[model samples]
Target: MVWRQHRIIRLNIVVLLYLMVCFVLCPVSAMTVSSPAEVHSVRGNAVTLTCTFTSTSRATSRMSVDWSYRPQTGGPPQAFFHFSSLAFPPQDGQFNGRVKWLGSPARGEASIQLLNASLSDNGTYTCSVRNPPDVHGSPTSQTVLTVTPKVPTVRFSDVAVLLAFILLPSAIITLALLGRMCCPPRDKSQTQGYHSPIEVTPGDEPGFKQINRKEKNMTCCDLYFLVWPFFFFCS
Candidate 1:
């Protein structure tokens, strides 16, 4: 009897372990929220909310998807959406006649589109999914909808515009100044009439006369010729 009881206890332990293993091996359904969770919507424009999910079994048309909203300060989630009987409710108050389901539920898509979004719709939103007996959990995602007032954009103050109009021209002027400083202008005065010594001939012009060095009362032209050799050597 003692051996039989021990065997029974061992069998129970094995059964418990097998159950635990089955539970551990069960796959968890996954849902994904795309980036840029928060989106800005213009008063007259539309915006779309995107999400993705994966599961071992194919999603059917009967699957339930619920989109809800909770204020930024936090509170009970508000039921803004429900999909079970292929029915959709009219947009409430500020969002009336402006919200749409962008996804084809038969294809497992759960995206929402908001048209003509208004300021009053600004708040946090959550998306949840239910896949029947296998999965029924709220894997939530949050988004802040903001309605902005239309304002004219002043491109003059934009950084790219400033760089093109102001900074670029300033840089070009600076470069020109640097170039001028590095390369000084040539001296036109010094090179006005430089004649080669070989090209110069005595009495080339019809002067009055060439006087000998022994003559007195020497003129400025005489002094110039006398010092020409010295000037050439100094240069």
Candidate 2:
């Protein structure tokens, strides 16, 4: 029983020493940072890279945050941003004038926005956070960002609305105007006058009246003579 007690106490002591050594190695921070595994963005647009962390100790102005990037083509990581009480943006390379820091160390937030992203911007981004006098724990996190081409915005509904409100009405009105110009309506009085062959004054000429009476009497006499032959044959 006495031997077992001594061994247990020794084991606890060794564990405490190991933790102490790990704490001493990175006294400035004992933080864990995490980010999404994947992020998507459109070409010529912007995307947010989120990195949140928790410190084992209280937050302070001395806290520092760093961001680095590695391309999909595979190469050494490039440091682009740093925040040690104040922001230190990237000075050179493709990220120059394109990255904006969006972190508040006191709140345990360390994020950034990449503006005007291009196809070449597809890569892995890493975030590291440090706060003083704490045992370090998982101080780095990574996120993979993918940039895709923008899709066309024209839709079937948009075309339908344009035709309904603009094109269709314009076409109807144009056809109506053209028909009116090509074949105009005519007045009834003008059409009746144009069809008549001659204009006669009824009571203006006695010779015309005499000719009418003579023609009427000759028509009766010719009819009587034509029926007399048929009557004689029957008798």
Candidate whose lDDT is highest: 2
In model 1, which regions exceed 4 Å deviation? 1-21, 27-35, 71-76, 133-138, 152-235
TM-score of every model versus the real structure: 0.49, 0.60
Write candidate 1's Cα lDDT for 192-228 as tens digits. Answer: 5455657666545222132222234454455546645
Structure candidate 2, residue pairs in collision: 28-131, 28-132, 30-135, 30-136
Candidate 2 to truth, TM: 0.60
Candidate 2, 73-156: lDDT as tens digits? 999999999999888998899999999989877788999999999999999999988777654588899999999999989898
For all candidates in order, the CA lDDT equals 0.63, 0.81
Model 2 misplaced regions, further than 4 Å: 1-30, 155-166, 173-235
TM-score of 1: 0.49
- Residue 166's lDDT within candidate 2 is 82
Q: What's the lDDT for candidate 2? A: 0.81
